[model samples]
Target: MLQGMRLTADKEHIAVVLNRPKYAGNIGSAARCAKNMGVERLMVVSDRDYPQEEIRQMSTHLAADVVDSIVYCRDLGEALSGFHYVVGTTARLGLARGPVMSPRDMAEQVVELSRKNDVALLFGPEDTGLTNEDLRYCQSVVSIPTSERFRSLNLSHAVMILCYEISMAEIGVPERFTPKMASSRETEGMYGHIGALLQEIGFLNPENPEYWMMHIRRLFSRMRLSAREVRIIRGICRQLSWYLHHRG
Candidate 1:
């Protein structure tokens, strides 16, 4: 009778992460928003201390569970370390943000993605938003469109928008099994291997290798590498390293 639950199970597979949030009230509000959309996992990446009473007051009783269960991390990388797919949200965009997707569009992808992989929807701080350096771990990014006259959005408002779209996605029904992507740990290890190998081969400039590696990251992000694929790439890097050492 309740077949129209609209994929409530997807909630378990997705985590809403706040990066370096400045306000405890906003964190609480974000938790309430996440709970409203059935998004259960809440993680906060911050070093600052926020009053627990203020947070619980803002969260209220409805989302007390979420606020109480929040996971704390020192940084974004550590916060999303266990996730397989990471999506970052930003108000400012340029070459560093990489290709951007609309919230609705990204939510559509999330429905399928969350079915097979642990997905992280990352949001930045209240003022500056996500920095270019912070986006290194994200596979892709989504930017919410607002009036050109005033572009910035409230932190909790942004969280509500993303969670709302994910909750209401039309393609929420499971059609097929999606292959799981590699976890952040696996992918980051693979990227590290590739970066060092490219540096050794002089394919990436030694002076500023990250500039070149950024492009490589985007290229591979599109490939949606699985754990097996990551292993294969790392294996290739190992073989290449051996050849370079032995051929001499």
Candidate 2:
């Protein structure tokens, strides 16, 4: 299901890292935005108390999966690790930082980076943006072009806008044929193929299959694998299986 593929977290490589977000409602809104944009992983780092339960409750049915999947971190650096590139979203211009780009330009750069490595789009707390220390971790800073007089946006609004821009970038790729939304059966079959391959490669340990499956899901969920991409991936897996079986 192409539509389902777009809705699932398996559609994007981007992860949202929230730094010291205060309100549970804000977190819930961010989760919803993440779900809409197919963002799978949500890393929240805060020294202060974050109402996890409230967020889960407020996320409703749409963001329930994302709220449940959130990972809590002690600090920004720990949350940002393993990501190849990081972008800090900010509205203010600092004396040291360079010029800001619109969401479209930023998303273009993000799409390029997504092809190569894991990317983290960091958002600071509602009241204060990235601290000087937090900024150190990002490779680049992104500012959504807004009216010069007023630029600040709600945390969830910012996330939604960023995701919309990213989605727009991938809307029409002439090289790839966009199939109609794949049915649940089709998706399940595709996942089965991937699971079998992972088991063969020892990524999904047979002894602790369930444990390994969860980990594997975490990995693939972040990729936001498209319907067409899933088919291509399964084909590769099949070819690998054929080669392995015939070689002997």
Candidate 3:
């Protein structure tokens, strides 16, 4: 007799997010992996219309029910909105990027985070991993360890590895010392406010604001500011804007 699968209540707090996925089949496969690992939510950030027939066929019965619950957004920021913590997956690293942790390390953190907050695991498109712009919204990036000969892994395969590790890991609830962090939407707004202030102060040249803004994003992402912390930063930006307008 085939054994029945057991489900965990805690899995409902975690979500898998696919950023600008090019293939419907991969989305389906990712959904299947999420369901198998007990994660109940899947969010897809893509502007392209995905073929329903192809996705359903690929998902089989394993995740057929989950297909209906999948949330679709046109951009990464929208898809990530409201999540308390966001973990992005990347295959490569650079000096400009935020700290990168191994999948195992990330799994430990994510398991604990899921206990009290909505946590997201982000996967980028198949052809290219998350761009610098796309990664700005991610608080941390998780890199899967692979042989130096070849670093690329298929989108679904990467999702399976992360979900599998998360499912098997044993985590205990610890005393909650960490305050609630800012949501992706709140942090994005802070960046926008600060960017505008920088432009006003002529710190960011209008002709080439992106160059400096990219560096600013990396710096603030590393700070992992909490909601109140972001509010304070925005307050300073507002004061600077006011000062520039009223200077004698």
Highest-TM-score candidate: 1
User: Please, what is the TM-score per model?
Assistant: 0.94, 0.62, 0.87
Find the candidate with the highest lDDT and give its number. 1
| Candidate 2 wrongly placed segments (more than 4 Å) | 1-11, 171-248
Q: What C-alpha lDDT does candidate 1 achieve relative to the native structure?
A: 0.89
Candidate 2 lDDT, 156-183, residue by residue in tens: 9998888788777643222444223322
lDDT of 1 by residue, 47-143 (tens): 8888998899888899999988999988777788799989999988788778899999998888878878999999988999988888889998999
1-248, model 3: which lDDT tens digit per residue? Answer: 12343322257878999998889999999998888888869999988999988888877887988888899999778788899788888888876666789888887877666666678999999999888777777777888999899987989899999888888765544544445677889988998999999888789989978788877876786675789999999999999899999999
By lDDT: ranked, best first: 1, 3, 2
Q: What order do candidates take by TM-score, descending?
A: 1, 3, 2
- The CA lDDT of each predicted structure is 0.89, 0.70, 0.83
Compute the lDDT for candidate 3: 0.83
Quote the lDDT for 168 in model 1: 83
**All candidates: CA RMSD (Å):** 2.6, 12.9, 5.3
